[model samples]
Target chain A: MSKEKIRELKKKIEALVIAIPRELEAYEFYLDLAEKSADDAPSKEMFMFLAKQELFHRDHLEKMMNDLQSQLEEELKKGK
Target chain B: MLPLKKLIVHTHHIATHFTNALFPVSAALITLYLITDKPSFETACYYSMIFGLMSIPVAYGSGFYDWRTRFQGRRTFIFDHKVVFGIIFLILASIVVIWRSYDGGIMYSVGLNKWLYVTLVYSLTGIATWLGYLGGKFI
Candidate 1:
């Protein structure tokens, strides 16, 4: 791959690095809400659902990141 | 410079422009959602906003990198406004995303919250325009 392409990949990885934490934070926020609303069964269930959704998001993002990282490494090795 | 740092310095414009482009699409999508009352439009708008939210940090990070490297970290008026407003835009976008996530029916609901959600989505376009204008001035 060309240098420009490598740079683009790096930029994408940087974005994922920033985004992953946000998904985790969202997960934590909902988890905390879920715990607090234990007595309110419906609200607690809703919060747990949201928390799971966030975890799913995080997992999806992490998969993307991993795919990108492997591609970046492969390209770097080819360049070398 | 290292490849990573070089990318940060050279790609701020690309990052910022990409982010600016996404917000308008998001704004328009949300407006269409309200007008047509279509669930798909709302879903598209939500995805656009999520994409926009993710890209903002990339833009903000690259802009900071460019400022520190190219401009010697000067605190000029335009830069100051961009930094402050950039942060504000991020916060507003996050609120809309989180609120919608918590309540899927927010857009359909009839209340101050629904209007507020719409207002926030529209405000994204205004903020993005201002940021783009300021960015142009910087160059």
Candidate 2:
């Protein structure tokens, strides 16, 4: 790829990296709301469940970054 | 990001939540219909389909948004009940839709006994709870 195109992709990737922590924060906030009330069994269960899912998302994102870094490294080595 | 871009992305995210909201709302309505033996059971089925259908795009889009925009380089799966649970419930909702809407209409019987419908609701509601759990973990 050309230098300009590479620059743009790099910019995009950097922006995405910034979003990871923010997304995790948002998920936590939402989870709190979900868990605040427990009028019924279902209500109690669902909110807790949603909170769990958000945590899961955080884990997934971290793993994805690690994998992508390795991939980027491999490509860099090949070019060298 | 520019304000316009952020607004667009936010709208997309909210739409996903709205779509998922359909499943529970419809499930509760279906329960009401079944208990009173109201003819409204058919209406409930229709509503369930609509709600379940909404989840497809919402789940897909919100999920896509997170994957593409937010969680691109993180270890997002270690605590990933959200991915696993969400996918399972979405699949179940789709199956229920097909089961109910077969033969092109509710009136057109697919020859399944009445008990099956009851079973479907129970199963779907149970799955919904599981989904809620996974979703909760995320928060």
Candidate 3:
């Protein structure tokens, strides 16, 4: 409701936004690993599995961002 | 005389090394992309996966053939572990690929939760690495 609280929420949103890309990078990296190990059947499979998992993390972060955005909007409305 | 068996073996050797060489580079690219947020690095990561995926069946096929022909009916611990891990990896890889296909190849899109995803990835990587270690011992 207060200016200070709104600023803090905005900062948290920024942090979450920054984190989303990092998660994407991780997902790509694991996929890359999986691709490389593909020749080594078992290793490749494992990496591919890991890559998928990373993708899921990135998606989760994105959902969190969406939730935070809605909350921020609600807070701003309350302040108004 | 370059027999078919020897030729297949040689092919497998090359395929294995080629695949192995790609791993660290892929890992590095991923790390770089994460830290720098560079699209160029991400491109490299995609390239690595493409090449690696192409090579998987070759390696797996050759390895499976060798196992069946050479180690048939001998359930050694190492051999068994390799087979089981290999299958697990395949299943996981399939799921990953299918998910990616549906998600339009964007990792940061909607689907599962963070904790579960992290746990699964870390666990899979650990297991894969262990499988590689066991493979090295046998090789």
Q: Give each model's whole-structure lDDT.
A: 0.83, 0.59, 0.62
Q: What 10-residue stretch in candidate 1 chain B is worst by lDDT?
A: B69-78
Off by over 4 Å in 2: A1-20, A23-80, B1-9, B77-79, B103-113, B136-139
Residue-wise lDDT of candidate 1 within B31-86, one digit each (tens)? 88878888899889888888888888888888888767655464445677888999
How does model 1 score by TM-score? 0.60
For model 3, residues B1-139, the per-residue Cα lDDT tens digits are 6656656766766776555555445556656765896767756755664565567688778877755643433344566687888777656545543543454335343445423433343444555576677657534
Report how far off residue A60 is in candidate 1 (Å).
53
For residues A1-80, could you state the per-residue lDDT of candidate 3 as single tens digits?
Answer: 87887777676666564456556557778887887776799988888788788778878877886787788788899988
Q: Best-fitting candidate, measured by DockQ?
A: 2
* Model 3 whole-model lDDT (C-alpha atoms): 0.62
Judging by TM-score against the true structure, name the best candidate: 1
C-alpha positional error of residue A56 in candidate 1 after TM-score superposition, expressed in Å? 56
TM-scores of the candidates are 0.60, 0.51, 0.51
The predicted structure with the larger DockQ, 2 or 3, is 2
| Model 3 chain A: ten consecutive residues of lowest lDDT | A16-25
